[model samples]
Target: MPEFDLIVIGGGVSGITAAAYARRAGRNVVLLEAGDRLGGCCHTWHPVADFWLELGAHTAYNSYGALLALNPDTAFGNLIPRAKVGYHFLKAGKPQSPFGRVGFLEAALTLPFGLGKDKAGLDVETWFTRLLGRGNWQRLLAPAFAAVLSQAAGPYPAEWLFKRKQRIKAAPRKFTHAGGLQGWLTELATGLDVRLGQPVQTLSMADEGVRIVLAEGELSAREVVIAAPLDVAAGLLEHIVPELACRLRATVMAEIETHAVVVPAGKVKLPPVAGLIGGDDAYFSAVSRDYLAHPDWRGFAFHFKPGLLDGDARRRKMAAVLGCEPADFAYETAKTNRLPALTPASVALARELRSALADTPVRLVGNYLNGLSLGDAAVYAAQGG
Candidate 1:
């Protein structure tokens, strides 16, 4: 028999959850992470006392059943209500509310269409344009989605949007932990045989089982779960599963840079809002911070367009959006590249690849195969998808 019933690669939310569930099922499982820590994209940083700035995913809906299941003792705090909420938009280098007079008129003329029923076989850009009108699509939909997806919108399937709409409407209460997502991840990782900093160099499937070659040593398992990003998975599976690797390579991935800065609460005058979306070809769609928990210090976090930018250029752009001098802000930045472009063709190819891998011992999990949310990944991993 193989050394373990299953070997799960990557220690992100999905991989952690999968290992936990496998343990619950009485399977001998081991999780491997390339980094020194777990919680791949759900990372938190503390630059100051009593201030936890999340560099990755910060919020979760009440409907995230899988996440809740893993850490039942977690305490979640709710976000500001929708009706009372407002966000800033950069207009002529100034931060203005979208609910202002000129913005209100534009919204009045365009917002109604977004509430209408979904249409079949439409791409995301086209569907939103048709449903919410061109004005709303440009001013609201484009930037808002750019922030959410961490990339510019392309020909994504409208079906995904429809499901997203339902999830949004159903999840009225958005929640976050006091210690951020890292606390919850730590709880989920407890007792699991996790090996950090042991990046798998290659993988092969033999008659005995799936062979995983790591920098330290080689390990074999009866089953393998690749919970890593698509690109990383493609490289690892190149020798064993060439067809699957080829398909994974075909999917486009977007890199996103996030900057978290702390500013004196008195110096920054932000509206009572959660976030702001940028207009035109702005580098960022949203710039905001955790206001509910830390009211004393204004912690600003912004997502950047794909590709790298020098420190000086990033500082200038952020200063422009916040209406503050670059010298005034103390900030830290992190870059990640797992957000897949879910265009129609890519979605079709993913589906085809998934179907092809169903019979094999190697199972795929993560935002690429499943949906992009922590909840989606957790549920999919639990189901062994």
Candidate 2:
């Protein structure tokens, strides 16, 4: 049995970042991953291509101070600013531009169902609606938010939307790492003791410390920090921390499902922009070009709308946008990964979970717990709070 001061479960961004922080604190740390490879969902496996095929997040905004701090050189490299955003709506059996990115959003606000454009005595949403207008909401803001969050609007409270605008308003349009974020995670793990292919199955606590049972064997740690998924961590800590487990189980993690189709750059027929959306299917579907900071290898991605977590329904819906058999476009690639969507309720639950574990030295971190950005997670872990 190996002994350490801290053990971080799950090799995803949060766990990796947590381990890095523990090591920086000069504490004995051991990191464990279930899969043979690290990066978890961020793992980009491109067989036909030479470079990393981003199966998960493509861009980390400039606002992600923690991510940037980990790589003082800005591992994201040169940024390709957002060029033009548009929506493809099917009218008369043809893809027609119903609205430009900004126009659609502005229009959406004016509609009765939308956040109207009345600014006087307006609250946060009304003010935002007036600022964006109906067209922008329908076209740009709505779709863009959907793309980032992986769910359609309306399911989340209006306040949630307002908070997000405030959080990322100053962020860059979008940026990708020169070598991909996986490289950065790899580099971050350096000099730290990481146990790869060892998934934490169970945990127990005693007066001395905590006992962790991994797939390989058992080990003890003076302090334990669970940085895996809430549900996953819940199961592991059910006996160790029943109160925290119950609290975590009560929370809802938004499920954002996306499928990536990697085609040869030469074979891909692309528009002028990198990210494109087709139709009002409550989601964004388009081909991604220059994904790996290279001008080749376009990846066509389909993301479900906000609150649209119907795995079967979403796949069926994407068939029309993708112009391919729905079965072929199934989310079998890199297994099925569900992006964590944070609603106000979920957000509150996360806060409660954090508070419960605050005193005992169990730190929770992830896209679900934090904001929906990889850079944010990195920054949160780097701050070491």
Candidate 3:
């Protein structure tokens, strides 16, 4: 078995960032990925005739400190170029306002106290009313936040909503890449030895180092970062701490289904808009017109918010939304059970888990531990890895 100074499990942004940090520190680091390719959820694919489609993450907000710190020269690089990035919101199956640079303003005006009673003092609206005054929440913020977060996870808690809104309100006008988010991963993985298709089956701590048993072989590392899915990490830790596994078992429970919807080139006119869905169902989708940026490649992706729609219900909803038969898009679906979520329980469990492993030398990182955003993962990786 080969040995290294650090071994990172999983190849998502979290794991990749960890590997990059360790390698930069002059440590012998090897990244192991179960999939044939890297970029866990940060994936972009350009099919034969279709536009660029992102199977996982869409775009990171400019406020992502970790991502910026990792690559200081943001003026030009792969993270997201200065163009091809815009924001919009949809209401009643139409743009909230007429097209132009006014989309952001329109969204800010309409969505804030999403789905709650128009009268102040209700859940989301109460907080918004406090921010923009009583009636202002109804006109500008609630609907917009509602429109975006509605498709995301749960009701936008007052605290998180305020923080996120402030950040977005102070962000750059446009962002993204001509080749898509894949370039960010490709650049970040440079100089690191990544072993794809290597699924780690077991991991253990030894007096000298950590031992990782993969499907094909075994390897050792002085320190290991368990950046895989919570369940995967819990399974490997069961032998070490069964009680921790039990606590983690009920902490996160959400099966996610991903589908890529192709909008015919020049056929569908989608003004650039991206946000969380509004309503009780919590579905988040980002609409992009410049992922590929070519006249020929036209494509968009819709992601089902974890724990939002059940399998059959989600399929039906997607079919109706896409205006295509179920079978037409069924083949393009990718499903991952136990997708990481930021539920209250999961959040609490993350704190508990962190304390549990604080002195163990095994750092746990992922979208689950932090908010389910590439920015969060990158920030965490840069800060500690």
Candidate 4:
């Protein structure tokens, strides 16, 4: 007999949700994580005991029903509401209002004609361009959305980019956990069998069920769920499902070179705003801690185009943007944020892969299978996809 009924690989939003669900269903489950912590993209950096900043995914919304449902306390009261700050665009090296670039007449003209249009088989550029006119998409939306996705948003599947889901109206429309999103996710994983720093090396089928091979030893489970990054997932599934793994390898993973800094609030001349869209610059955006105020410290995470700048160069640029010097930074860190470069074709691929694995004991979930958002991954995993 298998030692466990289910084994979930990876510890991001997807794996956690899968483990949580299977555990609740009375299955003997254990979660395996490759990293020192969970919450793959819900990464938060704590520079001091009292202050923390988001280095990856910055905001959570009320429409994230799957995530909000995991909250174990008094509903919305426990969530921290973000101050109403807005994202801005950088023009001529100064912060500019997002609306400053909008072409009102162009949008007004296209809205009537683009209404009720179907989004099937379309990319974000095509759908939004048609809906808002080329000028508006070029001037106002393109760069703004790139900042949101931390990549070139043009090729993203229109349908998967954003979906309409029912909102938890009682919760703040945009909020984070008390210690930040990562802290909240840790709380959500409470009591579930989680083993951090346990990276699964490979998988195979045994008489009992699936065998999960790790660096040290191995374990057997009646079922296994893979919730790692695209390439990692592809490599793990290669020997088990050759064809499916080959197809997964065809998809590419996008990387964002993130450089972050924490500085005293007194040194910054940039006003209180959510973030800055890079637009044609060497980066996608600069996300700030302004959404949730800190008494003396302010932090920013600049998601830059890979290989565009070196460490010293990025530090100087970050200081230039923040209206301070590199020396003003009290703390600093760097990380590479990766996501699947998904397209309309990738959506079809997801469905195909899901169907192929249905009859097998191996299950898969992550940002690639669904949309890139944590909530989207949660919803997909909650559905046992």
Q: Report the C-alpha displacement of residue 87, candidate 2, in angstroms.
A: 8.5
Candidate 1 regions exceeding 4 Å error are 74-86, 92-121, 162-172, 307-309
- Residue-by-residue lDDT tens digits, candidate 4, 171-196: 99999977798888888888899998
Report how far residue 232 has shifted in candidate 2, in Å: 0.7
Candidate 3: which stretches are off by over 4 Å? 72-75, 79-92, 97-152, 155-174, 269-272, 275-283, 290-292, 305-338
Model 3, range 226-300, lDDT digits (tens) per residue? Answer: 778877888877866678777776554455455555554445444544432333334545445453365654455
Which should have the higher TM-score, number 1 or number 4? 4
What order do you get sorting by TM-score, best first?
A: 4, 1, 2, 3
Residue 314, model 1: lDDT of: 74
In angstroms, the error of model 4 at 179 is 1.6
Q: Write candidate 1's Cα lDDT for 1-385 as tens digits.
A: 6899999999999999999999989999999999998999888777886877777776676666776666644342222322334466766755666644244565567667666765455677887776656767776767667766777774666666425422433333665566667666866789999999989888888677798889878999999998998788888778766886887787878777676777766656554456666555445545455345356776667676755566678777777666677777865655553577777665565677678777778888887665677887888898876
lDDT of 2 by residue, 148-204 (tens): 555554344444342332233333455554445565577667787877878788887
Give the CA lDDT, 0 to 100, for residue 155 in model 4: 94
Model 1 local distance difference test score: 0.72
Per-residue lDDT of 74 in model 1:
38
Residue pairs in collision within model 4: none
